[model samples]
Target: MEDIPNYVAATFIAIVIAVLGFIYYAVNTATPGKKNLTSSLVVTILVGWIFFVCVQTFNGYFTNLSGIPRLPMFVGLTIVSIIILFIWPRTRAILMEMPITTLHYIHIVRVPVEMVLWWLAVSRAIPMDMTFEGSNLDIISGISAPFAAVFMVGSRSKSRIGATIWNLIALALLYNIVKTAIGYMPYYFTPTGGEVANLGVFYFPYVLLPTFIVPAVLFSHLVSLYQLIFKKDQPQF
Candidate 1:
């Protein structure tokens, strides 16, 4: 096995920190009083990520480990993110209050994220199926986000219908990539057996995908949907 380089890991770690920092800034706008909790959330997520890296890479628990239906770490992180966005009272409220336009901008992270995945694929760290050329069409969502943010969100045009449709489409794209990723894992329930094992995801930086970015991006899509549907604050140009 090729030893992972420090620069690759360091660059990804920096991206993760930047993404979380942006999230904190965006979220703080809505829940000013939750500063302590927000800070704690950042700390907790970083700590959790460090622990996951240590376990999977340093401790060697996930090296060639197989037979599990799903990576428990991935599933656990996704589940916790769902609960935080949908079930937690204060957190849910803050998410709901977030400006729909900002939600659209947040998804721009997916663009760089997709590029990073492609780089990993080029390095043979992950499968090509997870990249733009394959089944993962999630980059479409990222590319279209800014346009949607401008036309649908900023203008507050009479295009609520268009906005709603865009969100649904982006959400579906996200779901597709997530489903494909899970199915390609090295597990008993995996849909296929091939040379490509999703071993890259278990390492540092990439682990942040399941732990931080995907969940956060997923939550962003969900909350945007909630705001579009439940709340009637659609801005009009």
Candidate 2:
């Protein structure tokens, strides 16, 4: 962890903040009458989650090899929570109200995130398998996000087929990286020679990758898919 450069951490922090800021903006613009209430609720939940993860990370809760692996548990709970939120009527409505373009644009953050992972791998803070140099090719989703948003989601676009295909492909890419990361967890798989522990994500700032960033990106993809498949009246732009 100490071997990783400070700028890497700084860049990751900036990415997280940018993601949160865009989320707040999306909520505010989507919810007209209850924008304030909805935005506040969203911000509070995200910030609270970040703080909780920070406390646990600092206390070495996730790094503990005893009893059960807390990092996986934390990830499972966060994913379940996102599922529940999407299932709940009010929350679902708020998320569904957010523009498809906004959801698509949110994925641009993944580019910088992938870069940070590569940096961490270079510093031996995490296994190289988690980066583009290895098995993780999730950066493709980030690089193509803007083009998909503009071309496939334009106001005069005829069909949602293109956007739907892009969403599914991007979602698959997300799943690939996530599975790779979890597979390399110390409790699950031991690293061999010349490889480093995947402990970077269990530390400060990087902890947000699993707790906040992944969840946010996952949620956006899910919402976009739902909108594309079910929402017939959704505007192209």
The CA lDDT at 217 in model 2 is: 94
**lDDT by residue for model 2 over 1-237, one digit each (tens)?**
888889999999999999998899888877989838888888998899999999989999988888888888888898999899788998888777787888888899999999999999998888999999999999999999988888887554535898889999999999999999988878888877887778899899999998889999998888888888888776553
Among all windows of 10 consecutive residues in model 2, the one with the lowest summed lDDT is 150-159
User: Model 1, range 47-119, lDDT digits (tens) per residue?
Assistant: 6765765566556565546555335565576667677668877667777777678788888778878877787
* Model 2 misplacement above 4 A: 156-158, 235-237
Best candidate according to lDDT: 2
Off by over 4 Å in 1: 1-7, 33-57, 64-70, 155-158, 188-194, 234-237
Cα lDDT computed for each candidate against the true fold: 0.73, 0.88
- Estimated TM-score for each candidate: 0.82, 0.96
